[model samples]
Target: MGFNPRDAIESVKDIATNAVERSADIVDSAGHILKGDVSGGVEGIVSSSMDIATHSVYKIKEIATGRGDDLDEIV
Candidate 1:
């Protein structure tokens, strides 16, 4: 059998997508914990959700544009 680069890239993309999703879930859960804080609970939840949502979009955009493994994606 021959190596198919597209399949390899797709595999990697799947892995990365899953990782991002799980991390987002963890972060979102943290927001729930912070929601009980009296001073900044709402702010924490809002900021955390917005950051995760935007960053998720950015990562998907990078993958769709064929720059999934670029250093920019890491940071």
Candidate 2:
């Protein structure tokens, strides 16, 4: 077959388009994974902080009412 310039240009264009599409897909997948990991980490940290705060408040209440002596029993 004859090597036509127009055909060669079209082939190059198609290859470039495919490469760009694949790269975009890879970036999109990576972004989703990173977002999920960050969201989960943030949720865990919030839960742990709330637990610590609740425990601290309970301890403060006990100490204020002279029930600190029974701390071990309550726990």
Candidate 3:
């Protein structure tokens, strides 16, 4: 049997196309999963930071005014 260059080229084209399609699917899935993780982590950090800030401000105000309504007074 004689080797045909045209047949070889066609075979390579099909394999390359299939590989590209499969790779695209993997990348898309990984991006979506990573995006969700990053988003949730950022939201949690922001919420915790806000809570700390609010508590610190309240404590400072009470201390500066010498108010008996400080957190210690309430608890």
* lDDT of every model, 2 decimals: 0.60, 0.54, 0.54
Error of 3 at 40 (Å): 0.9
Lowest summed-lDDT stretch of 10 residues in model 3? 59-68
Clashing pairs in 1: none
Residue clash pairs of candidate 2: none
Candidate 2 lDDT trough over 10 residues, lowest sum: 60-69
- Candidate 3 off by > 4 Å: 1-36, 68-75
Model 1, residue 20: C-alpha shift (Å): 7.7
Q: What TM-score, to 2 decimals, does candidate 1 have? A: 0.42
| Number of residue pairs clashing in candidate 2, backbone atoms closer than 3 angstroms, sequence gap of 3 or more or interchain | 0
Per-residue lDDT tens digits for candidate 2, residues 24-55, read: 65555556557786665555555545555555
Q: Whole-model lDDT for model 2 versus the true structure?
A: 0.54
Highest lDDT, which number?
1
Using all chains and alpha carbons, the TM-scores for the candidates as numbered come to 0.42, 0.41, 0.41
Assess the local accuracy of residue 2 in candidate 1 as a C-alpha lDDT between 0 and 100. 40
As a whole number from 0 to 100, the lDDT of residue 43 in candidate 1 is 56
Ranking by lDDT: 1, 2, 3
Task: List model 1 lDDT by residue over 1-75, tens digit each.
Answer: 344567557656765676576567566666766666543645555665676666556555555554546546566
Cα displacement (angstroms), candidate 3, residue 73, comes to 17
